[model samples]
Target: MLNIADTLHRWCREERPFALATVVKVRGSAPLPVGTSVAVDEDGNAVGSISGGCVEGAVYELCRQVLDDRGAPQRARFGYSDDDAFAVGLTCGGELDVLVQRVDPGTRPYLATALADVVEGRPAAVAQVVEGPEELLGGMLCVDAAGGIRHGPLTGVLRREVGAQAWSLLRAGRTARAEVGGDAETCPERLSVLVHVHASRPRMLIFGAVDFAAALSQAGRFLGYQVTVCDARPVFATAARFPHADEIVVDWPHRYLEQAEVDTRTAVCVLTHDAKFDIPLLRLALGLPVGYVGAMGSRRTHDERLRLLSEAGVPEGQLARLRSPIGLDLGARTPEETAISITAEIVSRTNRATGLPLSALAGPIHAGTSS
Candidate 1:
């Protein structure tokens, strides 16, 4: 489990065996999404959780059973029981398919290597066979960002196909299932693989050295973003100014962004109200494939910035991507509050949320499992 990677890695290094119960699939109303896991050691010590509280006891007992017997990997399903209220199930009315498996260096040598990558902050994904032949039940393969297969089986065409799928899911930072039928030449079995991805932290590039940028850096870090604060002024872009930023660049905003490694998950925030910095930086950011691009300014400033960008030959579609007069309609005043507003907008956009109050909407609070 990437969430408790440090603890798992520690156990692996100590040669302490543990049984892991991971939620491989969810049907509806689940408290946690796929890849949520709970690991139990031989001494009855546990780490992590599969359900918030609903089906934890059942899952823990399953883990203990696996540990006690040193048994083969097994899958258990849990859901609400209408007839029996006291049944061992999820009262939340969701269905979870959990895979319980034992882990140790001797049995799964690849696990230690995969855990090392996760703990060291590298992008990695563990593809485990959730449904397949008995022999391949717990087989796992590790795929890194570079498309290298660090460990596990499925050779030849099967390996290439699974690796490509794992890489795609890893890039999207999604833990999902992939099905593969019998490849006549490579293999002859229908399998369901659960790809548990541990993608690197997304980037949050704050293009300014103002107080707002400082506050935003902290908020971005809190949201698991690799925050970088950049400005042309050396004094303002120092580490002392942006203590929470993972990187502080003293280069021109546009220049630094031009060489920055931006992906679809990256968020670019132009906090510099100055046209000299904002215009050039936005011109480059809007055209890139970054997730969110917002600028801090007033209504008049936003209009002026748009006109300037149009004059600079920015396409209308690209200009439409800009979120000027940034942040939601929250009447935030202080820098800290404004930072919350900005990060909230970034999260809302990323998650495709409506940014509305939950009470105002009518439906399941947790709709889809993407986020």
Candidate 2:
């Protein structure tokens, strides 16, 4: 898991043996996603979480069993059923497929490199045999963004196939299980491998140094975003104003955005509330393939800004991408509440959610990866 990479890497460096339980698959309204993990040592110490404290006790015991047996990795299923809803069942009414395996650096050296990549925010993926023969259990293959195989034991066709699958998952920024070696004419025994992708944190560029930007910076950091606060005025863009921002730039917003590396996962928040900065920055941001672009202003200010941009020759299609008077309606008045509303809007947009109350909904509380 990305959250526990540092702790796991430390355990590996200390040569301490431990058991790692990963949520390989989930059904219905699961608490965590597919790549969530929990690590437990022999002394009953634990790191990370698999179900946000819903099914952790059961998974922890399962980890203990794997550590005690020192055998092939085991798969455990936890769910909520009417017959056993109160017996180690998830309150979220979801099913989780967990794979527990021993992490011994002496045997699985590739884990160290994978953990390092995760800790250092390098794009990488780890492919592990989740279901196969005893001899193949715990077998791992790691691939980085540069098409480099850091460590792997598989060779020939199988190695090539797994490497390609790992790369595909890395590009998709998802974790999934794939079936391998299922050609009945040649090899009848099929193997299931789980690929865990560790992509770099998404970027959140806040083009303002106002009080709202400081609160938004902290919120962005909490959501695992590499936040950057930029403004032309160096005196107002001091690090002390927004300590949570990953980067503070004393340059024009549009100029900084022109040189920034933004992807489909990146988000741009224009809190400048000024036409001079907003027009130029919104022009560049709306043309890019970023995930979100929102500007903060009153309705009157937004209308005037739109008219200015229209006069500047920005197309109507590009103008539609700008979310002026940004953030959802939550009756927010304070800076912290406003930050929460803005971040909530970003999360809902990224997840394709309706930003509706869960009690009013009927389907899964947590959106699926495909959603």
Top TM-score: which candidate number?
Answer: 1
Full-model lDDT, candidate 2? 0.87
Model 1: runs farther than 4 Å from truth?
82-85, 182-187
- What lDDT would each prediction earn against the true structure? 0.87, 0.87
The Cα RMSD in angstroms, rounded to one decimal, for candidate 1 relative to the true structure is: 2.1
lDDT of 2 by residue, 275-311 (tens): 8899988988899999999999999999999998999
RMSD of each: 2.1, 3.0
- Alpha carbon lDDT at 313, candidate 2: 88
What's the lDDT for residue 292 in model 2? Answer: 95
- lDDT tens per residue, model 1, 1-371: 67688889889888899998888888767788888889999999999987888888988898999988887998999989999999988877878889999887566667788889999988889888888888878778888878788657566777777787788899898778898767686458988888989998899999989999989999999999999999999988899888899999999999999999989899999998999999999999999999999999999999999999999999999999998899998999999999999999999999788899878986555576622
